[model samples]
Target: MSPIEAPTIEPVSPERLAEASVWIAKLHGDARGRAIEEGLRRWLQAHPENARAFELATEVWDDSEQLRSVVPFRPLRHVEHRPRWGAMATALACMLALVIVGVFWLQNVGVVATAVGEQRQLVLEDGTRVFLNTDTRIVVKYDKEARRVELRRGEALFNVAKRHDWPFIVTAGDRQVKALGTSFVVRKDVERLAVTLVEGSVLVSPVLPTLPEQIQPTIDAPGSIEQTPVTTALEARKGAGEFKLAAGQRLTFDAGAVTKLDTPSIEKTTAWRRGQVILDDTPLQAAVIEMNRYNEAKLIVADPDAAALPINGLFQAGDSAHFANAVAQAYGLVVIERGNEIVLSGKPIQ
Candidate 1:
């Protein structure tokens, strides 16, 4: 009789192979204990294929020191029998896949940020120019389907190179502005989001559920209607009360409602791009807030009466001293410079 043939072994899966690579990396680290050994033993005993996958991964890691060198494995501390192996393995597998695909890992995502009183311009891979305003941060992600930018904080102006097939979308403060071949500015503040269209058109929609209630329009708000005529004016497809904006239009969204301002001054709204801040009769408090965005030295209106004073003029961005002096001269407010703060107070009654 022929010798009894051993049971056929199934091939290991790529996922398992990746997981094994992670375990091998961990074992090479400083962590060692009976719990770790027992956990690994259980994993190996769970399936015959697990052992084979681990062996293959180990052999590959041993054979190529260069491949092993690519993985930046951190020293995990005091981790008992948890399934953290899956996460580590997935990371290792991804690194190896990046090597095999001839793609640098960092190339997938890009970040642009500006410090206070600073601005920058970036030309994206799609020939779109993005101008980041002071104290702004943006994450750019380009994929096969679309070019997406997340306005994580502050403001940015996007000059999109039209690609109808690859729509450019900007997400800011619970709102998404989808555009094609348009120039638009997205500003995200602590309590509100503003989108202004310079040219072309864009569809503005709320990112509900994903966004918290603090920033979204509530049902009880007067302007949270079922529809708006602005959508029709822009000739855009509407859904979920999404507002549409054409060139020279601006949409401001707060917790109360979304309001559209028609024919807004494109130059004044976008003056920061030219290192200027143009305020057309803006309230003093509001102007101070705007000025603080561009400068490390802050402007504080200690007097509520002084805070409500109207401000109108063009001032260079980041020129807090000049702005404070101008405000003092214009409104009879006293400007007191203390440390890094410029305090505006009502003048003494004469």
Candidate 2:
């Protein structure tokens, strides 16, 4: 049976919806983002449905950005179940993407992304600066009311222009970070998340009413597997937490409350920012981990004390082989590579 001529979701005003979509794209990728953009350019020169779809897609993108921007992100109540910067689930926003699109079907769209190892820099309407790191994706939300952003995966640094009433927030994992005129870093990793402060102060903590156990994810993109929801490690953020970082301090913690550790050193802490790792008498194992960031594979310390052998110098992030060579020469150790793992010892393993 022919798909009935569905009650078409009447296209909203071109300018208004288009404007709204722009805001949406700022926070989330839209139908017309890459696909639609290419499609639309082709449509304008070729046929009309392409143009119609592109136009409708445009409205969706613009409004999504606009609506969120208008609503603005706020610091969620301290619940502690929030994921840190490096370890947020990549599936949250994708689920909602289809919902937003379906609801506004025959609607508009907006936004952009960077590939793995790619960095993106954006300037918000209020002149705030956002820097994205490796495989990072973000959409800027702007509206008549407020400004906000949705971070999907990877890491980002926010240099915000603080406004007292309209606070700026970064949403990652299950937590919300409120920065009212500050600079901070948020990193999301597989097993952990972190929020680091570079300048000004940020209120880094958990969100209330935690993410329930047994998360059943929705597939938003093709060929992507949904994430299985996991429970927070600890109860509502407990322990002595709440980091008010100064110029060169950073805070890390799971759901068990904030753990403030002095950044090893300026050189060590900010190494990724400069694309360089300068270790100063750090353990071989620790150094190995840092070097592995530039590549894939687990660099294992064969001997417990093998890593205890401290060596220091500058190395690139994720350059495991070169770093291994450097480690061998500097600390009199042998390197062994097996599959995706690297091992260290005084003599190469046979």
Candidate 3:
């Protein structure tokens, strides 16, 4: 048998649609506190049309940037008070025309990604800017309550816009970073997760699991092997405590049970934005890993000695040859080219 489908929801009448737009404007405006919320609840409960109209208006608000310009010129009235019906009809007609002509309902949710050695910049409908590093993938979804972004892989810097009523959150693996109006970077590697706050505060916490009833149970035969979920040491050590990170602070979570939290230099943390990598006493193996993130060519430290050598200074990203030459001249090592791999080996002792 085929799966069941959800019932389709329809929008409310034209007059209610106009009133809903006014309510949305009021919600986003300076109006606040219990009085505003109470008024909204009463309006929504008055009729099914009022509720449906409000829901449609929210979707329009999420997708239509033009809707912002249509907000009332005069100070918004309280929810308890109603605007003139003739003016409301005029507004509704204008919104319908704009929706038919411009708004397509695509920008409210989508995926943004970048390839290796490629960088990208995107501005969301809410005016928040996202800067993606090499080999990054992020999913952006905006709703009435919040603006959410899932950092599926690689790293990205979020310069969030201020929306006090609407929160902004980024989720990576089991962890999430919540912000209001701030700048921060979240990087997800194969075995590690790093969050660095650049200019604003963010709350770093574990993502809560879904409700019990929503989870499906799995049954196995008598001789079958039970599948176990993989839990990293970092997650095991990261208890239920939520961390509030201030600007310039960095949190590193890896396979190790220890979670390191420290204040790192903002310049070094964000140097990738400039297509440069700055290494300060970083091991050859570690530096190689960082450089390979931006280039198709791979760098291999041929021996343990070569891999342990310390590297420093700034170098252009994706320039593996330049980095290899610098290392060879400085440490008297041998650089051998093998296909796409640049092998660095120690000079043979006499």
lDDT digits (tens) for residues 153-241 of candidate 2: 66777888766656677767766677779887887665567777787766654554543444312223432222223334433343222
Instruction: Report how far residue 141 has shifted in candidate 2, in Å.
Output: 3.8
Flag regions of model 1 displaced more than 4 Å: 1-108, 208-240, 348-350
Indicate whether candidate 1 or candidate 3 has the larger lDDT: 3
RMSD of each: 19.9, 17.7, 18.4
Candidate 2 clashes: the total is: 43
Q: How many steric clashes does model 3 contain?
A: 0
Best by lDDT: 3
When 2 and 3 are scored with lDDT, the better candidate is 3
CA lDDT, every model vs. true structure:
0.69, 0.53, 0.71
Q: In candidate 1, what are the lDDT values of residues 192-221, reduced to their tens digit? A: 888998988887876544444343432323
Output the worst ten-in-a-row residue range by lDDT, candidate 2.
67-76
Say which candidate scores most in TM-score.
Answer: 3
